[model samples]
Target: MNRKKLEALQGWSFISPALIVISIFVIGSIIFTIYISFHRVNLFTGYYEFIGLDNYKRLFNDTKVLIAFKNTLSFVAVVVPIQTFLAMVMASVLNAKIKGVKVFRIAYFLPTLTSSAALTMIFMFLFSLYGPINQIALQLNIINEPINFLNDAKVALKVIMSMNIWSTVPFFMVIYLAALQEVPEAIYEAARVDGATNVQQFFKITIPQLKPITTFVLLMGIIGTFQMFDQAYIFSNGSGGPENSTLTVALLSYRYAFGQNSTMGFAAAIALVLALLILVVSLIAQKLNKSDTLY
Candidate 1:
């Protein structure tokens, strides 16, 4: 072989061990999941029965699955937009040159660094009926009485949504901060010379320039929220309790795969559907992000 070809072959040989492991574990697992999604198999007994699309078809009549779909859709709809807006606003503030801004930036970014499970526990404490949040609200007479946030079906999901928004905003804020650096100061100055207000300059110049970054934020937010299992599992204690208000697709899939149900095929089908939902939402977000309507 030529010297260049020989060197290329040697490089492949070096990485082939890692590549083979990933293919078997990651790619092989994905194929197996899809395969099992079309069959009924006992994981413990190694008994496999081919039942084509039975699991997928059952999803149509499953009430819990329906609830999970609604809750997940609601979460993605409400959380993504609010988080995107909060992140953009926070990033703009941090990107500004001001005294002690760096300190504030670091403080704001701390929540994102925290583990989701830990954060959920913290939020649960804060929102508990006898917790500090209710106590403070009572002192100020803001609430007529301390509401049981954890057990209330009406507000349980909202509490999770708020906590999720608070935690995720800082991470996306950092992304927006990086994107903001790419905005040319000259454009803002030019807008100022034309008597464009700060708000106008923001809408006209800053946002349009950061369209690609916004797309990235939306795609990430959609995927993350769609597959949100950790926070929901922690909050509901894996039961999706208080009337199944907090049951997400990922959490439901977990219940099927490993919970009392032990329906791995149904779980795999749910996961596959969730993946497709994320893909579709991301493509739509990308198209909207590229549009010139707002600009």
Candidate 2:
């Protein structure tokens, strides 16, 4: 072969393994899921009876799907902004030349290292009736009685949201910290010379400088919160109980896919819907943040 053709062949050989694997696994799975989503699938029997758009039609009519979408939307809405803001603030604080800042950073980031399942359990304990949270409230007379956080429909989802925010903040905080390092100190210096306060510099200079990083963080947060499952599963014992307050789209999809009354086609449809939802929302968020132009 000619030298140019030989090099092209060699490059293709180097990438062929990854391409094969992705084609067989990722692309193959997506294609199969799409196929099943239009049918009634009986996996054990290798049966698929095509049913057109029935599954997608059911999505709009199903009350559980509605609840799941509501819960997931609320989750993404609340957790993304709060976690992004808290992560930025914590990153800024840790970036400061304060004593014991390393220790504080380590402590804050430790929660991110812990598994979501473990964190859910810990938060459940903390928010349980007569738990530390309730005890403290009782001692401070903030509540006349200890609140049942886990079983109450009103507070169950909120509890999960709080747990998600706490655990995720440290991860995004680290992202912000890394991005903060890239921000020019000279800009802050100029701001200071211009008699701008610390808060002013943070708002005007640091925030604008970290726009790309914030966009990344927001996208990650939205995707993660929308797909939240393990915590809700562990919290509600796979039932998404307490009036389905904690029922998320992922968990709902899993129930349809694997529950006693398995509906594999519906599950696949839900999964596809979730993927499209994430794509649309992430694109909108990216557009709003002008992340493409930030760089």
Name the best candidate (by lDDT): 2
- Show the colliding residue pairs in model 1: none
Model 1, 1-295: lDDT tens digits are: 9999999999999999999999999999989999999988668777678999899999999999999999999999999999998999899889889899999999999998999989999999999989999999999999999999999999999999999999999999999998888787888889999999978977888778877788889889989999998999999999996999999999999889887647888889999988887888878877876753323
TM-score per candidate, chains pooled: 0.94, 0.95
Clash list (residue pairs), candidate 2: none
TM-score, prediction 2: 0.95
Best by TM-score: 2
Provide the overall lDDT of each model, using Cα atoms, as 2-decimal numbers: 0.91, 0.92
- Encode model 2's per-residue lDDT on 1-295: one tens digit a residue: 8999999999999999999999999999999999999999868777789999999999999999999999999998889899999999999999988999999999999998999888888999999997999999999999999999999999999999999999999999999999888877888888899999989988987788888888889999999998999999999999996999999999999999998877899999999999998999888877877734332
Candidate 2, residue 15: the lDDT equals 100
> Which stretch of 10 consecutive residues in model 1 shows the poorest summed lDDT?
286-295
